[model samples]
Target: MTTATATTQAPAPAGAAAGGNTLAGTRTLIRFNLRRDRVRLPVWILALFLGTLATAGNYKELYADPKDRAGVVETMDSPAGLAMSGPRHYLDDYNFGSMLGHQMLGFMAVLVGLMSVLIITRHTRTEEETNRAELVRSTVVGRHAHLAAALCVAVLANLVLALLLAFGLSGMGIDGIDLSGSLLYGFDHAAVGIVFAAVAAITAQITAHSRGASGMALAVIGVAYVLRAAGDVGSNGALSWLSPIGWVQRTYVYVDNRWWPLLLCLALAVLCAAAGFVLSTRRDVGAGLRATRLGRPVASDALGRPFGFALRLHRGMLIGFGAGLFLMGVMYGSILGDAEDMLQDIDEIQEALQEIGGATIAESFASMVMVIITVVAVVYVVMAALRPRAEETSGRAEPLLATGLSRTRWVGSHLAVAMTGGTVLLLLAGLGFGISGAASTGDSGLFLKLVGAALAYAPALWVTVGVAVVFFGWFPRASAAAWIVPVYAFVVGYLGQILQFPDWMNNLSPLGHVPQLPAADLSWTPLVLLTLIAAALVWLGLEGFRRRDLETN
Candidate 1:
């Protein structure tokens, strides 16, 4: 009987169970990510889609005559216009399809790329930072599951956005915007997104923090844009081929309807994603391939102070945004000298500029550019304002709260940074714009005027930060809604006149209340009022944060 007993076999370890299947839990993660992004995905998709539709519809209204289109085409053919929009070849056809492809596609693709980068970083590195990925991995998850899932989510988002644009744009019954060209345009956005998603996937593996990963990926986008701009503006069209952004633009979607450039995008995406997977395998969980630098063994005096500590945490992002704003200012200012000349031929644009009330077309353009510059600075403000919430949710706030640090002090430190840092960013942008504008226009007075124009929006910027603070204090989960302020401001304040939107709609944004400076008489009343409103909002937020229970992981 003892001899007849069978030998028992033990099951393999959980890790061993998956064997070489590094992407074992990908499907589950994709579903989980999709569920988490339901609201976010729709908002991004709808905003982009509606904005495109509105812009496309207006093209017809704005340029009904062939001469109008041809005149605009001449403007676009210039180096300044080519750098801002696309290549000179886009002017060949200049149909609604070509117009849409030239003007909107590159900008739309960059936004989509940003969307994709955020999606990947949020799902991959962000999860790791929060320790959520570790908890998931302790189960049946595989090593590459998170990365694969993130890529899948990004792909899905791009695909959906592409499909929506394709069908929606074609269905509008606009001439020259055929389904084929629309599809090409839509997929061009998706291609850029996918390429950047791969870039983010690699960046995530390199950096320890999600923000760093995002920054690295965004920097790539910036480089691509710069390269594209330089190439398009220069005599060498081949230089444009070097960048992924330039690659998509070269597709000549509406003109030639070429589809080959997508192959390059696909190749790069595959290569980058594969590298990310290999890198993931080389590193430990919750750690980056590049080790974090060793800090001073002893705590510094600044570390003891809440404001200093908060600044330390925000230093990288602040510097990055500051540099970016300055460069953007310079770029915009570079074209300032020719702005009046470019618009001189376009009667519709001239009339619109007249309505905006500038002393000159250059001045009016500078005023509008100021609004755009401020809107960008608002991005930094919102991020800085929301930093405290991130700290609170991450459980770091608990240790500090247990000490002598009060909630108000802790939160105030970051708010101070948000407010002051935003002002600094605006000042830097103003200086850069002024320097470049003066050089471009060869008018020294224009420099100070542009700088003043940039600073004029500071009150509106603070108000934007205040909205984020209010959301962070009372509705932490919905803090992202604060972004609507800037986005709305950009749309209504920048394009509202052109789109013929009602004044009431424009007034809905704080930026709308701002006097278009340099172009119009600067009024102190609205600025003062906006400042008071911002102060009140901040106080309300601090009170709410003080009263409510802190969120903890």
Candidate 2:
């Protein structure tokens, strides 16, 4: 027997000490990622800035008088208002600056959290899944370098967003909003962003899949928001202390302007980064703390039928969506129960509604809440339709197509699930809102009225789904266009309310056409017209899908 000499493979160089990779190299990677996301990142920042400015402008206009401000404070101090927003301390000022501390703060926190999660996940797990991380790791870079760089990018983005918001709000003529307070507020918001980015970084290190990492990070954000909301509503400062959101809110800029809470945020961020770096050292390249197990080689009986398979794939998500919508609806509806009490104390609020094209206080409040729910429904629809795109990109579509399933049948299965599921979710939300509102008002008729009003927004929601379908079929490469379409609708619908834009401009949003419940006479004509438009768009999308090449990439 001839003995074969085995040549041992060489090990990779240790490369400059761990976490000591060339900063310039990491910076280069960061710049490249920024370049790729130039349009998107800037647009997000601009949107946030614009949103803040718009809110500042509206608050200035609505609470111009002391009586108006006092009324707002009284109403906001109520249980319903407290549940919906933060404490009403600044409401006493009746100035745009005061309102910013309450209204804009929560929204800014959410924006920061969202930007951090998206940015970190994009750089960490997303890059790894696309094999970009492997190519970069082959260089002399350390394992933690990418994460460090991504965190740096996220921090910079937060800084820029904070500065933009401060400038935007100041430009809107907000009074008594000193630069010091504004800067502190902005820094606190940015600090929260960094902390969440660290959280995402840690999640990415522990999860084997990008989806898992993204989901984990988002779940944390949701939890933080919920904790803060509960604490704020219940006046339990202890619970607030448990949440980063609460920490940021406690900053109370323009009111107390406490700086200590921000230090907590910074400490938590540093600790999370340290933990992530230590964990990274223990894991091999291209792997996570938990390894993913291979799925079954054969399809289960539940996945045998096209519709069954679609349902199986989407059941968890559908249920979650329905529950969330229902809860939101109930929350909003419950708040509206106090509208009578709220309006009784705030004549200015009522007058402002009448001036803004609303016929009654109830109608105006219902319209505002309905518009918000409609936007949420649009989001559900968009996410639903994007499921097919996700399956395609994840390579899961290939196996399903490899079976005897025809392309149209496979596509239709998912699309049917999305449309039907979205409709059901919206209806559930409407029912929840309507029932809660009716219960609170001791008026059974209000239930059906609110449901009808919510249903009226359905055609617009379907239109968004139709847009996603069209993009999925024809512009597969630009399927992100689907996300942009609904975002545009959202901007159009809400920005007008925030900025007090002209009627003609507001009319551009489809949801704007829906009659304000309890305020305007319900008309079938506009609803029918919207339905027809939705049908046309759906048909166009299907036609495009049929003509285009079946894309899996």
Candidate 3:
């Protein structure tokens, strides 16, 4: 007892840094991440840059009138404005480019942030979940290197995105854009992205699985948007400070061109990433700070069945999608009241919709929003339909198939969930929109009209399901390629109306064929024919699933 000297060993190098250089392989990993994201990063950057450029270029023409400028101010100050665009930071004068920043900056920041989150998660938590992290770690890879690599790639992407925005805005030769202001605006978007990339890095360390990490990161994004919306509309400018998107707006790009906010973003990003590095060293490979909870030791009888198991697998995703869509619906619905009133100032947007869609301007606008919602719902269903392929490739379906359960029943159970879950989610979104619309107008009768409009797209959604089912059954490896269908439909259906594409190209979209309901006449011909086509595709897909061997990775 007397000889017991308290020998406190030097505190182990605070976590993963225990391995001397925690970022030993960070540069290498960054190179790999860049290669992996070459296609994806460019696509995201171009989509946002081009969209922002196009919108900005149009502002001079779109709102040249003094009255139109005032209308833009009014629209920005409206509740719908609060919900759609964060806040009007540039209310001093008609700084058209600055006004454009207020309208599009908040949402674009969100998109950029989401891209950051996905990029980080794909390289970090997703790799860990797939055991790829362990494989990498087995070599001389540093503990903090993966995260550092992910962040580096996201940062590079953000820088490129900023340059693209700056160059695009500056090159437009628009009088509204000042070089300094354009640079600020572009960098502001990049700042927002890097901050969220840091947030994703931290989030990736919290959950054991990529899905949970993604969900948490996404939840943060949603909460940020809502918070920003609340602060902007409720006259609580202080509240806006709480949100990342709000922070982006606070940058005051194109207005005073504030540089201070970028510093704040940088600080937060650095802090979060440092914390993530700490977290990386503390946890074991494949484990999280918030570890996955243990499941019941015993299985219920329902777990033994196919449909029950399928439902069990998909319930979380369906709930998440439903909730997100419902929120989207509420936001969209809140703005419909302003559709007719606001456009008196700038009716060209209205005229364009009415011209392209052959419907009343107000009704066409509402229909457009409704159809977009349906397309999102279709995306959910298509993903759901491909679950069997995911399960099969993951080796989870092998056991299920080993039992007496036929492949048809096993696969069909996922299809069943796709159908039911898709319908429920679509209806939920519709209900949210309808209820919000009615409440806003004090005309509770609008509930049915909006809900019916949403449900009307069910056949269109099923068409996507049919196509995805065919891909899953026939070309399981290329099932993810099915996402192109809805995305293509949405782009063609929505953008085509703006670009005034040929009717043939527009009609190619299944969603385009659906009558714009609640404002336009409903026809049974397209619905019936689309449903029939869906049924045939579903049969073919299932038949292909029957004939093919399991295409497990």
Number of the top candidate by lDDT? 1
Off by over 4 Å in 2: 1-25, 88-94, 281-298, 312-320, 340-360, 393-396, 494-507, 518-525, 550-553
Model 1 per-residue lDDT at 183: 95
TM-scores for all candidates? 0.96, 0.87, 0.91
Worst 10 residues of 2 by lDDT: 15-24
Number of the top TM-score candidate: 1
Give the candidate order by descending lDDT: 1, 3, 2
Which window of 10 residues has the lowest lDDT sum in candidate 3?
A: 10-19
In candidate 1, the residue pairs with backbone N, CA or C atoms under 3 Å apart (3 or more residues apart, or in different chains) clash, namely none
Instruction: Give the alpha carbon lDDT tens digit for every residue of 92-142 in model 3.
Output: 665677777788888888889888899999999988887788888776777
Give the per-residue lDDT digits (tens) of candidate 2, residues 1-553: 9999999986556444344653436777788778877987887778777767766666766666767667667777866676566654555554556577776676578677878888888888877876678777777776667888888889888999888766655555567676767777678778889989999989988876676776778778877877777777775456767889888878888777788999999999999988888887778666889877787999788688888888877776677678778988887888776776666644445554564455445656877777777777777678778778878776778887788887678777877787788778778988999888888777788788788877777776776777788888778878777776556666666555554567886666677776766557788888788778877777777777768765643
Clashes of each: 0, 0, 1
**Candidate 2 — what's its lDDT?**
0.75
Candidate order (TM-score)? 1, 3, 2
RMSD of each: 1.8, 4.3, 5.0
User: Where does candidate 1 stray beyond 4 Å?
Assistant: 1-11, 345-348
